[model samples]
Target: MQIVSALSEISDRYDALFVDLWGCVHDGVRVIPGANEALRAFRAKGGKVILVTNSPRPRAGVERQMDAFGVARDAWDDIATSGDSARVAMYRGIVGQKVWHLGYAGEEDGGFFTPPNVLDDPLEIARVPLDVAEGVVCTGPPDPSAHPDVMRPELLLAKTRGLKLLCANPDIVVDRGDRREWCAGAIAKLYSEMGGESLYFGKPHPPIYDLARRRLAKLADVPDAAILAIGDGPLTDAAGAMGEDLDLLFISGGLGAEETGTPRLGDPDPEKLAAYLEATGVVPTFVIGSLR
Candidate 1:
């Protein structure tokens, strides 16, 4: 991958850009340095930017959080989240079926039963026990370490009962301030490994990309070849871009810096980056130390 200093270096090649929210635009609590400015600059030059995120929350909820973080509205032309796509997927897949939800205790309304867009509702779902439920929907963990073991008994019960798992967020982990927390994908992946049916609705999955691509198309009639995907996660961003056949702009000093031997605070080591890309077997079209 060719290393560059800023998005402007290669921004002119694409009519639209699919940018990741968490690691590229902001860490959990605050905006990343120069990220908003870079996005605004890209847009100023007539590029449509879509904030495609693996966040478990819907676009409205994420937009509110971004607004609170002082992220300007002009930084992005549109937004799409894994939660929104998952809701659409679940609505179609589990019409009129009972499902048990596994997620943060207080965020019940965020599930498929009561989506942000009521027009897309396909069912009048009735909650049921794990053994009797037709499916299971996982948004994310309540705690930082909530993963395979934390939800093992429930997941096992669902597995034994043959309930399909709909994972809202395919991201395994994300930074919440200084702590890294496991997302719904961790449980879904474990369930699949144990011979259970699981459908992931986010990155590295076609469904979420389909939604994002539609949104991108609405903003501009850009082909997949002309769209650039920017992100930090190798598993989610890089894998998703490769799966969708889009070029990637990998941010080397973000989430996977340690494994890639790129320092978090300074310039990335090109040799180390090459090794990391070789080992992961996924290469981006370009590499930037930061979104700037």
Candidate 2:
């Protein structure tokens, strides 16, 4: 549990790196300063880097977003996203099954599937017979204003019907440029709390890490022991790394709401960092202000 300044310190030790996208490499809108340089340096040293993200968009869509933000595809060896993973899971079972999607209407269609029934209105869909559907998938952002009392009737419907809830993204909340918004995982978590069953398909889950590792193995001759997971979020990236038994390099410049003065946990203070970690019980192997 030591602090480091840059990725170069551990570059030689790790043959591959699974880097988080949103808060670590870039904000929602723009790439972080020196992030590209750090990746280039890692590549120069013959290290493979994979962009691992919890974005609910498909791999191609995520790449398009990266391209739009000037993040070159050549910077990373591969890209794996929760949306892509979920799509794979969905199609692997129950072809042509009815799915009640509970996110943004069009967002889930990126690569997931065009189910027989695509219900944008949760209330309208709830009135229909739930026995007709195979399962429920949460892929879009929740609209709190859609209902005053309860914003998630879809979860209730899924629970009542004893249907499986597939959560595409495991991130509870993400920093969209400057605004923080609840993603599909938040709703999935809420449903799980209410005695609902959900299958998560993102970071903090072993499958996504396995996919990244498999892809990395093809690009680099590094052992699993020589791979590192670098990210800003403790819950997703750090926890995922620890679960996979990989090294961790934490970026603390993003994802903190309070401007406390610490610079390690994105808190402006050490006390804040300690408090946050104590509450979450997520401790990283190394910490730094930024990748630079």
**Please, what is the TM-score per model?**
0.93, 0.85
**lDDT tens digits, residue span 72-156, model 1:** 8989999888888887766665522778877752243344355456345565666677777888888876565755677778878
Top-lDDT structure, candidate number: 1
Alpha-carbon runs more than 4 Å astray in model 2: 94-96, 104-110, 114-131, 142-149, 257-268
Model 1: residues >4 Å from true position, as ranges?
105-112, 116-121
How close is each model in CA RMSD to the real structure? 2.1, 5.5
lDDT of each: 0.81, 0.72
Model 2: how far is 97 from its true place, Å? 1.8
